[model samples]
Structures are given as C-alpha cells and as structure tokens.
Target: MSRSGVAMSRRTRLDSELVRRGLARSREQAVAAITAGRVLVGGIPATKAATVVDGSTSIAVTKGDDPGYASRGAHKLLGAFEAFGVPAPGPEPGPGAEIPRSTGPTLVVAGRRCLDVGASTGGFTDVLLRYGAGTVVAVDVGYGQLLWRLRCDPRVRVLDRTNARNLTPAEIGDRVDLVVGDLSFISLALVLPALRACAVPDADFVLLVKPQFEVGRERLGPGGVVRDTALHAEAVHDVAASAAMLDLGVRGVTASPLPGPAGNVEYLLWLAAGAPPLDADVLAGAIAAGPAGPGRRA
Candidate 1:
C-alpha cells in the first residue's frame, strides 16, 4: 500500500487512539494530555494530537488525570504563583484556622473577588478557586465552553458570549480585587483598558502573554509559533508598555512552565494597578532565569 493509503488504512490520530484505548475520556482530554507532555507513544513523548500511528503502537498516559485541574491551563497559573511567590490559600479554613499572608507585593487570591477573562474550560477559574478566591466572574466570548462543575460552583458567575474588550464596571457589578486571564486570538492591549476599568485601585493581575498572537502573522514560524527570541522580548515589552500606558505597573515577567500547543513558549505577565514598572534589567533577569525550552534563541 502507498504511504497515504497505509496511513489511511489502520493509522489513527493520537487523540483518537488514546480515547479508543480508554486512556482518555474524550479527544479533548487526550489533546490536553498530549500537549501537557503526559501522553507517550512507544516511550516517546507525543507532541501533536493529530500525529498518526499504527494500530499496534503502544500509548500510555503518564498521569491519570490533569493534575486535579479541570484543564491543563491551570498548571500555567499555578506555575506563575510559584514563580512570583504569590501565596495560595489552603483548603477551606476551620473556625480557628488562619489564612496565609502574602510575603511581598504579589497578589493573594484568598478572599479576593477576581475576574477571569477568556475563561474557557474554567482552567484559570479553577486555579483561582483552588487558591481561595472569594468569588470569580468567568467571562468568555464563546458560549458553553466552561466546565459544568465551574458553572455550578456558587462562587463562579458565568458570562458566556461576553467580550472582555467591552466589559464595564457596571457589567461586572463591582470592582475586582485581582484579575487573571489567558486570552487567545486577540492582543492584550485592546483589553487592558477595559480590565483596568473593572478593577480596584490596587488590584493585581496575572495574565498569560501569548507571543504567537501578539506578534504579527509575518513573524510567526511554522505552525504559528513565535520562535525568535527577540520577537519574544518585543512581545513582552509591548504588553508591558501597554500596561504602563494604563498606569498598571509591570510587577514581573516569567516564561510559562508549559509551551503552547504549537510548541511556542508563552509568558506570564504580572501587573498591579497604579504601581511603577519594574526595572528593565530586573525584567530581563527574570526572563533569563525562567524555564528555558526549545524555541528560546541563545
């Protein structure tokens, strides 16, 4: 049989194969597992969900669940908390239990009303809740994408089909104490002003900075990945500048612990309302000390 024919004969997409073998509950879960570096095929880490393999190939999930989060995006926020020294509160406190206090200017999620933009699958929202957010307003432009458990959680207010760019304080009901976002297909510049309007004077932010979306299409590498280190730096700088224009201080910048789906290295940007931007040298040092990976140019 020809190569195409052979591929069509018994080969299956890795996500489908994972579902067929009962390794994943659905193709979405399988893709999450694959991109999170948890799925291995014949002892090799699978990089793409659409990779085709023969029927007899061995496939396994290195971890049974998505590390207890609703989606892999939770890991990104969790990593930011650790990297920035933001304290996450423990489980619901008993009558005499005390909430942990933040050591620095890093935002503490405990007891804070938060806003989660681009809250698809409720991953960031889940992280907020896990860290003891008093309440979370989950907003997404798309409808019906949040997880059922999050939608049912009393603390999460679902705002499906809502555009973050047009959000107002009246719409959000009250000013938020903190904001977390993981937006795609749009620049954070367009939404930062709106987020600023919806937050309190000293509210902090932890937003995922996706270079693939920030950089122009002409700069993207194959599969829409931002492979140039200078472009990565430019993207981060642009976002920081935009935040500065809004009077939101750039608290810190760090590379994401996990790469994007197309193997692009993403970044986490920490900001606070009405604070001064970090020193350029300090920001550069933080980026250098962050997790390094394949696409980082020397």
Candidate 2:
C-alpha cells in the first residue's frame, strides 16, 4: 500500500496493459503503437512491449489520432506505397480526418485484384480497399482477426486459416494482380514460394521484411531486436535471394516508415516479374533512405 492507500500490484507487460485498458485492441496492436512512437507512459515514450508497468500506469497514445489503418501497419504499407510510388486507396490518415483516394487503376493498389496475406486486423486490407482494389482476398493463418468492417465488405474475400505457405492460385480462384503481406512468427522465405504460386503472370507484391524473424534467434541482440545495420542488409539480401530463386524479381528494399512491434526495424521489399533486387550498394542506400527509426524504440 502506498501513501494514497492504493496497492501497487504485480507488474504486467505494457502491451497487455494497453489492451486491458482498451487503449489498444490487442497486444500486437499495442506493440505496433509503441513502436510507432504513438505510445507514452508516465510522460515518456514506451520503448518496448515488455516494459513492466502496472495496470494503473499512466499510459496513453500520442495525440489520440486514428493511426489511419486499422492498426499502425496502415502507416507502414502507406509508407511503402508512397516511397515506392505505388499509391494506395484512401485519404491520408491524420488530424482525426480521412483523406480521399484516387479514382482508377494506379500503378499499384487502385483497380487491382489483390491478396493480403497475414491480414491481421485488416490494416493492409483497408489500404487496398481505400486505394480501389477491385477485390481483395484476405488470407491469414489465424481466424477472425480481421476488423468487422472489412469482414462485411463484399469486395473482401476472407480466407481464414489459410496459410500463405500453402496458398495456391487454385485456392484464390483467379490470379491476383497485386499482393501485399504483413506476416509474423515465420520467416518470409517459407511463405514466398506459395505467394509466387498464387500471383498473376506479372503480379507484383509489397511485403514487410522482419529481420528478427528472418535472422536466427541466436543473432538477435537484447530484447530480440536486430540492432546491427549490417545484419539488416544481410536479412534483405537473404530474402532477396529467396525471391530470386523463385524467379520473383526484387524491385526495391526500403526501411519501413515505422518500426515493427517491440521496436524491431522492418523493411518493405517490393517484388515483381521483371525487376531484380537492388544491387548491394543501391540496397544499402535504400535501407537508410527513410526516417532514422529504431532510436527511442530500442
């Protein structure tokens, strides 16, 4: 018991506490917020998901703004689209306001038949829809994680329990013109083969590259983050190598505008039929092109 006669109980994870307080929808969402520099505790930014804070800790999100997508991932995919000049559907998310989207087929999201692998909570799906994808097949290994709004939309074909590793064009019915993915807990190399098998002859994809999941655990530094810039390049090259073997040409690799959950810096790898992975020097430059993240979050 403290001076106020309130007991300070057991310390719990910051992410779980955020969920318990309804500040975030899930632990994953909480971590996403924290990593995006959206979460603050006791007037300070939260640097990791494992921050041991009490349930009553003074936790709050930055500015109470709607982070655009269903989760912070919307910012990530949007960053990829804009940085790569792909463009997505919908208005820019900010100032508690929504931005309007383009009208027709863009070089990317607009008017495309798309697939969203690991579409948890529909951040990527929301981007696709807002950008004008003719249709979206939301595939996830888990069940019932997509937002209800996306679930009810007729244009979205929900495929729950569908592992991207096992996905085939036959399963999706028609080839998708564009594919966007945000997967966790598995190396992308395992999912690339299936993603290749399900795309249109010249389909393109924008997928999040998580280094912690790609590099063996033994290589991860404290708090399970890849702190070495060299390792970041290696992970990209390794995954680019995987894509090449499948004949999915790598277009570019850019550091995500946002860090991944738990402050893990992530990259967006663009793949298509014609382009090849950026040469080592070019890729190194791209990896450092965006905002220098992984600062406070670490």
Candidate 3:
C-alpha cells in the first residue's frame, strides 16, 4: 500500500538501489558509503547494505563522507606497512633526476607482482597499486564484488569465485613478489599453504589476523569478538606457528590502526619466506600493546 494509492514494487537491496538510482556509481561505492554510516533511508541512517526498501522509499548519501579508499581494509594494510617500516615506492624520477640507493634490506613494492587474497572491493589491492605494485592478481571467492574501476585497470587481474585454499601458481601465471590478505570467516592456517605456493622465494606477506575466526567458538565473547588478551595472543601465536611449519617466517605483528567492521581489534601479520621465526617475547609484547577492549557494534 502506498500513500499515493500506487502499489510499491518488490523490495530492492540498498546497495543495488543506490546504483539503480545513480546515488552511487557502483555497488562497491555504495557499500563503502553504507559501511561508513553515510547512507540514509527515509531520513534515518541505514546500517546494512542488505537492507531492503521499496521503490518509493527515500534514500540519501550524506555529504562529505568519503573514506579516501574503496574500503576501510586499506587502512589495515597501510598501518602494517608503517609499523614494519616497509618501504613504499616513491614517484618515478623525472628524466635525469637522481636515484637514491637503499642502505639496508627492505621489502620493495615498486614494480613487483602481488597477490591479494580475499580481495573483496579491492581495498588491499588499491593500497598495493597506490604504493606502486606493478601488477596485482585479486582473488575472491565471491563474484562481481570488486570496484568497476579496478576491474578495468590493466594492472589488476580479477579472479572472482576462486577459493584461495585451492589456489595454485599456475593459475596466477607467475610467482608473486608480495602477498596481502583480508579474509573473513576462514582461518588463515587453511590458506597459508596456497599463498606460499603462489609466491616467489623470499616473498613478503601482509595478512589481517581476525581473532574471532582463529580462536575457537567457545573462546569468543558476545558478538563474536575475542575480548581476552590472552586469547588474542594465543590466536596469533597459533597462526605464526602454522606459518613456520610451512617455512613462512613471521617477520612482524601489529594492531590495525582501525578496528574491524564489527569493532573487533584485528592484527596485521608480516611474513616472509626464509626469514627467522617470530620471537615469543615479541609476540607477547605486540598483543599486550594492542587495542585493549571488547568488541562493539560499529
């Protein structure tokens, strides 16, 4: 029943409606805007992208709500790079400009091939490209979630509906110099082997560690967040051990600058093939210094 005496059509998803109404250029942008609390329905804030609305329902995007990236996951990777002092590629030197030489061993991203596991909406992939990765193969289990601009970028190869646990080097066509991941619902241990198989020798890795997925269900507090600091340490330690068994060294670990979508305090793990295992003391210190609090609804 409509106020104007016209029957409303079937409900449409908020993200799709944003696209249909030209409020957003793509579903990815719509999701980002929604997640950032910028989307309004009938003059009230809309919380979820999956929310359904009728044809006549009013929708609005808040002004000046840009997040500066396709997804907030970009901040997680950026934080890791800063905490670990990983070198970002500088702008190209103009003709005859002086080139600076490195004084120590550094994980260089310039002109390097990369693999982005669980690259939904291409947040991490966007950061990699901005930092100067030459090529990025974005793999996700779901279909049609990447930003349209990233899909059109020649440097990005979209591998939608592909499971990372079964990923192979042959499919990627070449060994990657770096690997970055921001997976959900799945344990990193299950996909570490596949990631290792697709990387070059001595390749670098920056993976988000979601404690809620790594810790057993019994350990999770309300709302699926690992609130106990001890549990957080245990989860990270277990994943680091798993990587070690696969010959992947845990180079560093740090808390993400921003909490996860659910306000779960997530971690960023830096790994490298053939590097030394992470020291137990360093692991403990990182967990102790991490964001101290329980998860909350964002």
Q: In model 1, which regions exceed 4 Å deviation?
A: 1-67, 91-104, 290-298
Q: Tell me the lDDT of model 2 at 105.
A: 22
**Cα lDDT, all candidates:** 0.79, 0.77, 0.79
lDDT at residue 173 of model 1 (Cα atoms): 90
Candidate 2 stretches with Cα past 4 Å from truth are 1-68, 87-107, 290-298
5-56 in candidate 3: lDDT tens per residue?
9786978778778989999986657766765678989997675555678778
Candidate 1, residues 1-298, lDDT tens digits: the string is: 7766654448767877888889888655675676557888899676655567777898878965564677878767766775566543433457985654544455577899999999999989998887789999999999999999999999999999999999999988999999999999999999999999999988988899998999889989988988787788888889989999988877667777667888888888888866666566655665664443111211
lDDT for model 2 comes to: 0.77
Clashes of each: 0, 5, 0
lDDT, model 2, position 251: 65
Scored by lDDT, model 3 comes in at 0.79
TM-scores, one per candidate:
0.72, 0.70, 0.71
Deviation of model 1 at 18, angstroms: 24
Q: Model 2: which residue pairs collide?
A: 88-131, 89-130, 89-131, 90-130, 91-99
At residue 264, what lDDT does model 3 achieve?
86
RMSD of each: 10.7, 10.8, 13.6
Q: What would the per-residue lDDT of candidate 2 be over residues 126-209, giving only the tens digit for each residue?
A: 878876789999999899999998999999999998889999999898889899999998999999988988887799888898
The reply for model 3, stretches above 4 Å from the true place, is 1-67, 88-105, 291-298
